[model samples]
Target: MAKVIMTCGNLCSGKSTYAEKLGKELRAVVLSIDELMTTVLGRELGDMHDEYVRRCEQYLYKKAAETALAGTDVIIDWGFWKKAQRGYAREFFRQQGIDCEFHYIAVSNEEWERRIAARNAEVLNGRSDVYHIDSGLLEKFRTMFEEPDRQEMDMWIE
Candidate 1:
């Protein structure tokens, strides 16, 4: 049975890195919202960033369902930060008669901060396609992200 693996984590929590590894291990296609947004929108969406991300996520969710229905596994690297979002994803796949698994990547604050700094440096050096996180953006993401409890996740990577 094909399945959708959803990644839950905060910024710089290594969601994309883990998704890449898991996708290869599971022989799944990795659908990354960040890659989609950055490739199409040039790494920055400004004031409409959230709205744009929401739209992209909707599209990806539909595509993931289609792919899974075709008997191919998919790994969504969107950082499903909120419990409601995770619930919706689970139900969406359930309604399609597809299996879904939630994987949460847990990172300590110190490590997360260090990773963010390194990522920012990579972006600055033009060595990565990811967006740099400033103080304001970091705070915004911190406030927006909702940590998931153990029961909400099928797998945990710390």
Candidate 2:
């Protein structure tokens, strides 16, 4: 039986890196919205970015289930910032009769800021396709992200 590993974290919390390593260890398929969005749409969605992300996530959720059912473990490299989003993912897999684990990557404010700078440099240097977190974008996500309680996570990575 295959399992689903869902990553829960804020922006630049190293979820993608963690998922990639875990995917390799588990022989799982890693699905990421940022990878999909940036590869297909190329970063200039503007006001439509949120809508595009929602659609992409829906598609990935279906794909994850399909891959899991085919006996391959799946890693969802997503920032399940809201509790509702995490809950929905758990229930979605539960109803599918697939085991699911939520791995939360917790980072301090100092570390997060440092990571933002590093990631921004990488993006600006054309070395990475990930989104660059501007002040406005940072503030938006900071206000939007609802930190998950410890009990809600199956694994916690600092």
Candidate 3:
């Protein structure tokens, strides 16, 4: 049986939403790296530097591996931004004969701007402590985001 499903997308791209939906559909455990990074690192991952991000990502991946090895289905919600990240994840799942699918959540710039505006408003209102996306930040991320293709992902939604 398949044990791994990687949900890939940039920030504010609805990856978490679709991951939750897929988790419900598959009855799998959705391992949100964002949540882990926020809780464990005591800060939103978006605020972390590359080295810190890599460390946090490693911990998340290790946990996912453990969860899947325990026979629980795992859905990871993250950008999986670089090929190295996806390659490592794919190899780990392949070695275990665990099924893997990638869902690339896609959204328009308008949607992303809307989401960021709403989120930033929440931050300003004291509803959140971190992860405030300014007006141009979403555009910045979109610019840098590299979509995962067939070579890195077997399937995509969006």
Q: Clashing pairs in model 3? A: none
Best by lDDT: 2
- Residues 1-158, model 2: lDDT tens digits: 99899999999899999999999999899999889998998889989989999999999999999999999999999999899999899899899899999999999988998999999999999998777889998899889999999999999999
lDDT of the candidates, in the order given = 0.91, 0.93, 0.76
lDDT of 2 at 46: 89
lDDT of 3 at 57: 75
Model 2 pairs in collision: none
RMSD to the true structure for each prediction, in A, is: 1.0, 1.0, 2.6
* Model 1: per-residue Cα lDDT over 110-156, one tens digit each: 99889989999998999987778899989988899999989989998
Q: Which stretches of candidate 2 lie over 4 Å from their true place?
A: none
The order by descending lDDT is 2, 1, 3
Which portions of model 1 show Cα errors greater than 4 Å? none
Better of 2 and 3 by TM-score: 2
Residue 125 error, candidate 1, Å:
2.3
Model 1 steric clash pairs: none
111 in model 1: Cα distance from truth in Å? 0.3
